[model samples]
Target: MIDYRKATVPVWTLATGDVRVPALAGDGPMTAERLAELRSVLAALADEPIATLEVHPLPEKLDSGRGIPLDAASPLAQHLSQLITQSARSSSTAAKATAAGEGLYRMVVPAKVAAQLGQGIVRPMAAKGAAGGIRGAFVNSTTGRIAAGATFVPAGQAAAAGAVGGAGATAGVAVGGSAALTVAAPLVLMAIAVGMSAHADSKRQQAIEHITELLEQLHEQKLEDEHSELDGCRDAIDKATAILLDQGKLGVSLGLDSAVHAINTALGAADRRLARWQSALDKLPDGEAVEIGTLTKSFPGVDDHGGTFRTHLELAALAIALKRRVNVLQAVEHAQSDPGNLFESFVRALKRDQQRLDELESSIAGVLERLSALELARPNGLRPVFTTGEVDRLMSAAHRIRKLGDGVSANSRTTDLAIEIARDKDGSVVVFPALPASA
Candidate 1:
């Protein structure tokens, strides 16, 4: 749905294979490249069992067509601001980065490690009394360790390090493909990689199935997008796709305006369907009493037992959506919840998931809502960028994917598409920027 040619990509971190450039610590505002460097530097310091967070400080009243300046205003910014102030004061040394080093990253670790490092900092490292306003800083929570920042600064390098410190408060900001306005730090990128790697070994077979189905569906939709029933619809989808890609926050969204709403509706359907399964279980003599493992063990001639077993399989298939929502939650918390507890923990997770869903729905809805509210106050070219038909396509694609049912759906299909996606977990059938021919 997007035009990759017109959009810019957010600066990739070293870990994500960011392009290396000569140190331009000063002589410029904090452009995308400088942020890439600072992100890379912090990543190397504590790559494992540690989380790195990039901090970007924006100028007053700056707006990009893409949603960056707003994304920077997330709670993450406030957290980073406080953490940096604390770290700058507590540590004798921090990064020698100037304002150009505005992309400085902070490493997260256990509290004890941070204490050992003594007020580890993640701010622009001007001298203690060096000139310039603070770019940004983040203090560690008592538990999340703030390490590596202080160590990067040496005994007498603050002034040189702080050279670009003045530019740290730079107002010039631009986003790359799909970066819209979320936290585009390498730390979050690394987290996505690490989180995906954490799927259960037991679910490997399921993951394979899901990935296969996802690839097929994505391929089909890509073809559809390339050849929409209406040229107007296709063009709108392309622009919307660009917005999603350029925003870079949400990945592989179905190019539908009401896409999020449809997803929520499906989640609601799945929940209700799960309730039916629960009702069926109550009819069985040993249904609720049975553990998760024996869900398939049928009793002699109990004709109805087969239905219960099928329900088990149904829940197993729908697990991908459940897994995805949970993963997003984990990323935000910066902690992993027990995987084994997915079903058992689902009840506990229900409220939290609903709350999270509401917030997401609101955020996404706000974009459209504001666009509607303003009537003509469109900024960053978002007005013509979104379209109702695209919303329809996004919703349609999501529905088609659901019909191919992962966990639970009313539609039943006999093809491999059904079996494959219903059992897989690698990802959902939705494609963000649309998949490649090979995928």
Candidate 2:
């Protein structure tokens, strides 16, 4: 449940003459000026394809007892409370919910789009259509015009229809009279308000604060996702390296002498890149850009300009690239012959790693496509800024690695490696490699 304010404005009134409500003025506690300001905000949201809305309460700031209160008896409020309770149960969610404002509003896009949009980029387009009709009704309801039962679309229904096309609505209600409008589906109105609220400078700052927290959450998530793959790659390298050395001790020279060297060289580059990324992250300013209420340490050491963050991001991507290259070296000697147990394991691991890399590559491409769409949607002067160089590099690297992974064939001759030390028909360094005949 949230603390509240009651609206002094008219709730339901007939429209008079040519006067039409501007569609953002829900009959809550919001003012006319705020509604007008929000119209501009919604206009900008024309291109944002928002998928969902997540509501978060600011319990610390709720002590002021301000803002329109959700109807506790309503299903919408109950559902929200349930979600908040669920979120509180999650340690990860609790760590990420550093919002110090009255409420933290979030646009939950599809997971694929979240890769870039969640990174504190420019505000998403406000739901302009969602705010339509509702505010116009509010303004007209006050003008004392009688249009003889010309029904004003209830605020909740109007918002739902305009915003999400009524996909998530559980029920609709109309509050009649001069008092505050008791919305049935408060979530719709809440989202509409949050969308429009960001145009103001102060609200925009709060949105950024919430976005910063989201960015940190993303960083943590990315690291967690990559941890297993990274460890697995390193273990595979160690295991394969030891195998090569043991083979040499037994005087079995399968022309794999260069494999270990290649693996080490590839790994060294990955380590250096990771080290540089960490150094860059450490060098960024740790101070809060602006303090809201008592929360001061939001987004510690996060690069607002996205340079260092991109470096952090690309390391994981680059790790995948490095792993793919290293796996090629593992495909030597018996890999194409009578596949020994060790070679079989390497092949399986390589296949699995390749599958994972393909998945990641697809996700990255999705992000890039969305970013490109965002660029094309906005005018040149209003384009959102991004450190796309790292992203582009990662994409290119992934493409090359994926191609190499595809080229690695179990059918390739034992004399040659499929992914490394081989050339394609065009004389490119890509065909299966032949193992040394001495083995």
Candidate 3:
């Protein structure tokens, strides 16, 4: 067992022809040259028990009985300075070791004594004794004060020990060796997993393209079907209009009003469907490309060999325009039910409805022109192309229908005397005039 009180003071003794200083006591600050002198003097006095010296006040006389100047510039100071310079060089080397991931054991010392020491010092013998099991060193830079605990090791040494074992077996192992391989395996596997996930995402994007193409095809087909249905309805209105006009000219009437109403109703239905198709077309995703030829070919009953059917289609389109005019006239009559501000509302509604009908009529004319051009481009042997005159006839008929609608619109504006009489307050009580006198 060690005595704690004995460890606290800086007293050196000689034994076995060598000087031994207490590790804890010498750990205090002292000049390198002074420490070396003390060690040399003690070494010369081997086996001698030296008195405990007070380091605070230097003596006026020494072992040689000569006055020794303690001033930093004196000869004695110069000798101390050389020893201090050597100690400083040694301390610098130790500091470098510490800086290179080495641990430090700080030994606190008084500042004034450290200045007189001329150099920082670490007693190797004291460091070895104080560090029981931990590896470290004792550092001193003072002459009069006691030092504290000094054992230390590199800060990373403990963590390195945990990596291997408490025995520190793997501390010297290189980073890229088998030990590193064990850590890298999981990271490599994780990278491969991420790459495969990215590939799968790319495939999903491709599939989306395929699905969008399919949707586009379906939408085009729906449009063709709607166009065909509208064509058929237009044809029916044309036949009815022709029959009614003939009946009216013959004074037969043939309930022409009802036939006109039927034609108008059919045209209204077609207009509503066209509006719906336009809405759906507008809603399609932007930049969606479709094959124009595929869309035209998808129409049922489109003859590839003769192409004569296209002219019939053109005529059908013209009929739809005429039917639309009839519908507008009927709409104006219906709006006449509200006689209040009737003229103002009627004129506005008529102009708007007439504009829409004109636009549809223009579209019909454009389609007819395209069909005619397509026919002209074909070989002459294809069934005789419908005469341009037939298209002109259809247009003339549409113009007549428009004129008839305009006439009906004008008639609706004229206030009926019967209506005026019916609206009179005393209309129910008809008063008979006095009997006329005979001449």
Which RMSD values do the candidates have, in order? 23.8, 28.5, 50.3
Report the alpha-carbon TM-score of model 3 versus the true structure: 0.20
lDDT of each: 0.27, 0.29, 0.27
Each prediction's total of clashing residue pairs, residues at least 3 apart in sequence or on different chains, is 41, 17, 7
Ranking 2 against 3 by TM-score, winner: 2
By TM-score, highest first, what's the ranking? Answer: 1, 2, 3
Superposed model 3: Cα runs more than 4 Å off:
1-322, 325-328, 331-335, 338-342, 374-439
Model 2 scores worst on lDDT over the 10 consecutive residues at: 416-425
Which stretches of model 1 miss by more than 4 angstroms? 1-208, 211-254, 286-439
Best by TM-score: 1
Compare candidates 1 and 2 on lDDT and give the better one: 2
Q: How far is 347's C-alpha from truth in model 3 (Å)?
A: 1.9
- CA RMSD (A), model 1: 23.8
